[model samples]
Target chain A: MLNELKNLISKEILLEWRQKYSFGGILLYVVSTVFVCFLSFKKIVDVPTWNALFWIIILFASVSAVAKSFIQESRGRLLYYYTIASPQSIILSKIIYNSFLVCFLSVLSLGVYSVMIGNPVQNLSMFFLTIILGSLGLSSVLTLVSAIASKAANNLTLMSVLSFPVIIPLLIILIKLSKNSIDGIGWSVNYRYFISLFSLDMIVIILAFLLFPYLWRD
Target chain B: MKHWWKFVAVLFVLYAIIAGFLMDVPALPILHETIRNLYFHVTMWMAMMVLMTISLIYSIRHLSGFKNEHDIVASEAANTGLLFGFMGLVTGMIWARFTWGTWWVADPKLNGAAITILIYLAYVVLRNSIDEEQKRAKVSAVYNIFSYIMLLVFLLVLPRMTDSLHPGNGGNPAFSTYDLDNNMRMVFYPAVIGWTLLGVWMMTLKIRIKKIKLKKGL
Candidate 1:
């Protein structure tokens, strides 16, 4: 099972890299969003608000990037071929690959955003930890939801609609933890948010793992 | 055709009206006139949950096999769910305006409910855009299941996190205590049951209509 999972993950990652346009489009979207935020809040962007904007951009970028993962799989019976391997393997691979992509984009965007908004992080390590944990929850949920929504008629809109509600709890926790971390609050002050976020990610990933088999069946 | 159910539904609608009007009398200082909307809003939310649950069941059935009835059931239930969701949204907005002095606030409960409704609306739009019946059914079934799970997360899970002026928040206690007294319970419980039955009846009728159209190749 581990070998199969590894193989599927490598395949997807290679496919992603080969599709340069997809990666470029998502990166450009993130950059342009940060640029717009800079222009719009040139004079009044505070650390908290900038923190909020940073996550929102990352959230939307993750959605856009992950929504097409399954659609691409369905392009020409690729989903069928993958199922011949193992549905669990396929889903796990997709989740892992997408998590990597989302975390990278989130960090990159946060760097650009901090430069643009000029808000120095009081605790850079803690902020990065929060982002990493939050991105795991975000990417896991988005990958599961996109798999479900990819087969929908309006994949893009349906993905957004379906994912937003599932991710709201995660978002609430992320925003709280990120805000506290940015404000230099100790982990003790924001520990509940971290635990909640971690638990949510685990619950969702387990549920998705159990449910993806049903979705993969012909 | 047995029409007794319709008669019973009509009687319940009349009862709802009477309960709503009585709820408006000035004797209740705590709730006052705004309590009238509670009959509709709370009942609509209950109905939405019932319909969404039905949709989830049908999606499960659909995913298990290509049974046409399951697809029909899923779509009909989703339609009814959307109807109740809209009613819940409008009623909640009006209640917010009167009680909170705003048309809408980012109150976790209210915002979560609104976002859930939007997600389901996107489900319907997705079904409409697809031209192939089998593909549409399969895709929609998947999307419906995803959205329903998210709806549960939003409506059930997220509210526990933050403080809100809404009932059932901040350790202030939930409405099930004094807010739902015997008098309100008499009306409220029946309203919930009646609306759910009505939604199911509507969905059955819609399924029959769709079957007829399919027979005619429409």
Candidate 2:
């Protein structure tokens, strides 16, 4: 199982590497969106708005990036992959790959957003940690949802429709944790939220892992 | 015995409605006369939550057994639950407007309820988007279970994380602690049970009609 998971993940990464423009397109999306926000708001906004705007950008960007995890696959390619890999490995690989994509996009967006909109985040490290956790949570959920949507005629809009509601709880946590970071609160004050966010991510990943196999079998 | 519960539901709700209006309520500031909304507004939410749980349980059963019947039960229950959810939201809004002087508040609980409604609405959209019968059942079952867990988090867990204008969460004085006087509890408990039973009865009726349609090859 472990070997298959490793091979599947590497395959995912290799495929992503080959599709350079797709990855680049998401990065470009992040940059352009931040630029637009900068143009609209122009002046430096308060910490809460900055935090919310950052998450919203990351949320939509990750949706587009992760929606293709399964939606872009042809039936023939999926069948071929199914012949060689376990269902669990396929979902795990997609989740891990999307998590990497989201983390990278979030970091890139944060850099551009801070430069353009002015970063009000007081505790940069804590905020960065929240971004990573948010990415993990988002990718796991969107990966499963994309798989479900793919089975339903590969509808991208349906993917977003399914994901936004499921992701809102995680988004709320992410926003709150980042707000605490913006306030530069002590770690003690933030630990409860951190634990909740981490646990929520775990629950999503575990659920996807258990349920994807059912989705896998035709 | 089966139909007996339906009569009980009608009786309880009728009792609640009449007594709820006529019974004396604790003279509380702000809430004042509107305190009576506890039986109506809050009960709708309680019923919605119960029906959604029933739907979630049926989704799990569908995944396990691959039964189309289970899928119908899940979908119908969700449909009924959405009705209650919307009623809960509108009622709560009216209550909030009267008491809080705003149509909406940035309260975690309120936002959580709104998001829960969106998640379930997405479930319905997912069901409609899929054309293949068996695939639709399977895919939607997975989504139903997944989103239900997220809904639980939104409704039960998220509210406790931050301060809320709604009672019983965060620093707000929950009805359990101060309000919910003996007079109110008599009506309130029955109201919750009555609404929940009524929601379940409606779901069963929907399921039976769907079954009839299926039987007629419609």
Quantify all predictions' global Cα lDDT against the true fold: 0.78, 0.89
Candidate with maximal DockQ:
2
lDDT of 1 by residue, B38-74 (tens): 6788888888888889889988899888798899988
**Per-residue alpha-carbon lDDT of model 2 for B1-218, expressed as tens digits?**
75899999999999999999999988887788998899999999889888888889999999889899999999999999999999999999999999889999998888888888898898899899888899999989999888888888887887766677788766555676544478888888898899888998899899999999999999
lDDT of 1 at A68: 79
Worst 10 residues of 1 chain A by lDDT: A74-83
Stretches of candidate 2 off by over 4 Å are B170-173, B177-180
Q: Which pairs, if any, clash in model 2?
A: B168-B174
lDDT score of residue A123 within candidate 1: 76
lDDT, candidate 1, A1-218, per-residue tens: 89988887888888888998999999999999989988888843476677677888998999998887886665567645554688788888888888889989998897787678775567778888888888788888888877766655657776776677668778877887878877888877777777767777887788678777766654
Best by TM-score: 2
